[model samples]
Target chain A: MAHITVTVDGTSYKGEVEPRKLLVHWLREDIGRVGTVVGCDTSNCGACTVLLNGRSVKSCSVLAVQADGSEVTTIQGLSDGNEWHPVQTAFKECHGLQCGYCTPGMVMATVDLLSENPTPSEQEIREGLEGNLCRCTGYHNIVKSVSYAADLMSAGPTKGAK
Target chain B: MIPVEFDYVKVTTIDQAIAALKAGGEDSKIISGGQSLVPVLRLRMAEPSVLVDCGAIDEMLGVREDGGSITIGAATTHHAVMSNPLVQKHALLLAQATATVADPAIRHRGTTGGALAHADPAGDVPAAALALDASFTIAGPGGRRTVAAKDFFLDYFTTAVGPDEILVSFSIPKCDWGSHYAKFNRTAQAWAIVGVAAVVNVEGGVIKEARIGLTNMAPTAVRASTVEAALVGASSAADITAAAMHAADGTRATSDLHAKADYREHLARVITARAVRAASGI
Candidate 1:
């Protein structure tokens, strides 16, 4: 076992984890951030998405040890704790999610996307969130949510925080 | 599934990383970015005794233009390649193909050297490297040496890089060549069923020079010699398309559920033509 410290959700965490423990397992097991789901242990599915150093990455594919000195933001980290992030708000208003299994990852990936492109075109939205998969909604609603989030984010801080 | 337990050493320097690889020897795996190798490990397709992490080697992470060539560090991410102006100015074919690689997340983490070293037959980088005539700079205890991209790839998932040697960087000569990449993929993030990269130089309405590299049509990324030969004097779209029909002439392709061999061959021909037309501007 190796002892490592990770900064997750803006909080410092110290734990003793095995060398092979994946970041997804660490997120759920050690950190108790169960909102992050691991749809496919392999990378083909993007269900276990998270923001590492301000970029989205499939958490399951990364070993916990690899994130030793990195900052990770899971789905649980999105809001300022009072409300949903812009992506979550847009996802809800646009009816972008159903069953909600892939929502957390979709929301996180969308947050990363919209921050990079505040006013993404419809096609650009689709292309930006291509790494994320939302089978429950057939991606129609998810794309809508991303588009809505882009609009809301373009409107500035008012729409997202509320 | 979780991977088997193994010693993991995240080295912070290129020399340290290379030393770890040397100590671990043949059973060691040098991992950077881990976009491609991680999945393989989770699936248990490969079992290495040690993983020498090269992600922390900051020296291997950036792009710059020196003299007449654009040099990109081995650890530089695909996103960096796409965003860097030096790469855009000198190797636009590389930039465009880098954009088409796996999607945003993978692009954010995947490294240029890792992709080239993986050398998947369906990958876009090898073909792009071939099109640009890039050279790889590898380092080991013996110091540094450069190998032509054509000779760098030995076979499927294999390269001239030995276990002890680290792929330090890649250097691509700057050119005024017109370049383009055309790929046929099943989805937004799926591997290319077939991809083509073309670089052309047209002089006075006739073809002065042309180079074509094909993906998913052979064991390794191979050049379309027949197409190159046939398009030498032909300046018309129809003639180039006819020449591109021979794109898959020299290789054996494996068929899978995504696409059959015959269909892939057809895609190679069609994509090659489109790439040539766009690149050669005819």
Candidate 2:
């Protein structure tokens, strides 16, 4: 077992993890960050996507030990108190999800995407979220949510809908 | 899908990585970004006894100018490589191909060296590296050695890198040639059904020099020398299309779920023509 210190959302957690432990499993089973769900255990589905050191990555494809000393931001840490993040607000406003199984990953991926490209085109948003998969096939509104989130973010933090 | 338990060793230097690999024995595997390796581990395809994490190795983490060539650290992520100005200016084919790998999230965590060392025939970067004439720098107990891109990929999921050796970086020669990677895939994140990496130097509407690399055409990425030779002095799309007909001359394409060997061969011809036309601006 290897001891690792990782900061999730804003809380730092220290644990002894087996070398084989995936970051997604550690986040869900060990620390109770179940917001990051595992869809396809394989890396194809980005249901376990999270921010690793401010960049998006599939947590299932990263070892817990590899994430040692790194900061991870999951879907659980997106809002501040009662106020939702612009991405979260946009998803709700635009009805980005149906079954909601892929919402967390979709929202987190949008945050990362908008961070890089503040104002992406429709094609760019489609290409940006290619890693994520929604079995419900609700991509039309998801793309709408991303574009709306871009608008919300660009309008300033104060403009987020309650 | 939890992987089998194994010992993990994180190293910050190439020498330390070499020592850890030596201590871990032949079953040990070196992991950088863990994009490919972790997936294999979860699938239980590879059960290494020890995993030497080279992600923190300082020497293997950035792109630098090395005279006429640019040296990209083995651990440099695909995102970094694609956006790197040096790589864009020197080896645009690599940047173009790296941009198409997996997706934004995968690119964030996947490293160029990791993809090259993993040596998946369906991967996009190996063919780009071959087209760019990139050379891999590997470090072992006996010291360091450089292997050309043409000779680096030995077989499917295999490389010239030995068990005790760590792939340090890749040195790619600078070239001011038009390049394009024509990739055909069924889905957004799926592996290339067939990919053609083309780099051509055109002068006065005539091809002066050209290099072509085929992906998923064989057990490893191979150069389309016949097509390359046929494309020289050609001034039109017809010439390029005719030249691309020989793309499957020496390729060992295989039948798979995505495409039959013959279909892949046909793709090789069609995609090679498109890539060459775009690369040469015909």
Candidate 3:
């Protein structure tokens, strides 16, 4: 076991992690933050997306030991623990997901995307979410969800929580 | 899948990193950014005893200019390369090609030196570097030595570098010639099945010079010598197109799950023509 200190979503947690513990596994298994799901152990499926020090990365590709001393924000960290994040709200409002297996990662990717590009074209949205794959919902509604999230965050009061 | 048990040590300086690599010797590997090495480790494609993390080395994480060539630290991320004003204004081929790797997230962490060191023939940066005639500065126990880009890549996934040597920086010359990079792939974020990087100097309606580099059509990123030879004095669109068609002649393209060799050869010509036209400003 190796000692590591990671700041996730705002709080600091220190623990002894295995050298092989992936960041996604640490978030979902050890910390019990199941909101960050793991789909494919491989990096292809972006089901374990998270914000690492502000930029979005596949949590599955990030090692927990490598993530030491970094700030990570997952789907569970989006809101103030009371209401849904703007992107999450948009995802729910626009009916973005079907099976919901890839929703958390998609929502996180959307959150990072809208933050970087406040106003994105339809093609930009498509390219932005290319890393996150969704088998269901056909991505038509998911694109709408990202656009709606952009509008809500850019024009509404839920901006400070991100 | 969890990687097999291995001891990980994060080294801070180049000397320390090199020392660690030598300590572990054949059983160790240097990981900078982990964009490529991490995936390989996860797939069990490579397993080493010690991972010398070069990501934290401050000396290997910057971009600067010495005299004529712009020197980039080995650990500088692709995002940094794309955003750097020096690289954008001078080595735009490097910047442009770096942006097309995987996606924005991967770019944020992937390093230019790592990609070339990893030596994936289908990757965009290596071919661009080859077209621009970049030189690599490698550091080892003996001292520092510079290797030209053409001589650096030996084969598919093989470089001229020895085990004890570490690639410290790449020096790219500022070519005033027009350049363009084009990759033909199946999806928005996939490896290039076939691609071309063209650097041309169009002087008074005459093709004064042209350097054409091909990707995914051979064992390594290669120069289209036949096409380049045919293009020296030809300026007309038709002549250039005809010359560009020979980009894949006398070559062997490895057919994989992505596309067939003939299809890659076909796409090579197509992308080469587009690259030539774009670079020619026609």
Best by DockQ: 2
Tens digits of lDDT, candidate 3, B1-282: 677777778878888888888998798888877878778888888888888888878878888977777888989988899889988877888887887888766777779999988888999988888988999988888888999999998888888777887888888998778888998888766888988988888999888889988888887888898988898888788888898889889767988999988888888887888898888875
lDDT of 2 by residue, A56-137 (tens): 9999999998999999999999899888999999999999999998898899899999999999999999999999999885
Per-prediction DockQ comes to: 0.82, 0.94, 0.60
Q: Ten consecutive residues with minimal summed lDDT in candidate 3 chain B? A: B101-110
- Candidates 1 and 3 compared: the better one by TM-score is 1
Write model 2 residue lDDT over B1-282, tens digit each, in one string: 789889999999999999999999999999988889888999898999999999988899999999999999999999999999999999999999999999999999999999999999999999999999999999999999999998899999899999899899999999889999999999989999999999999999999989999999999999999999999899999999999999999999999999999999999999999999999899
After superposing candidate 3 on the true structure, give the runs of residues whose Cα lies further than 4 Å from its correct spot. Answer: A158-162
* Alpha-carbon TM-score of each model against the true structure: 0.97, 0.99, 0.95
- State the TM-score for model 2: 0.99
Position B180, candidate 3: lDDT: 88
**RMSD of each predicted structure:** 1.4, 0.8, 1.9
Whose TM-score is greatest here? 2
Off by over 4 Å in 1: none
Q: CA lDDT of each candidate?
A: 0.87, 0.94, 0.85
lDDT string for model 1 (B1-282, tens) is 667778888898878988898888688998888989888888888788899999878768899888989889988999989889988888989998899998898888899888998888888899989888899999888888999988998888888888888888898999678889998997889889999999888887677788888888888888888888888876899988999899889877889999999999999999999999999899
On residues A15-94, what C-alpha lDDT tens digit does candidate 1 reach at each position?
A: 98887888999999998999999897768678898998999988887889888888999988888778778888898898
Q: What's the distance in Å from true for residue A115, model 2?
A: 0.6
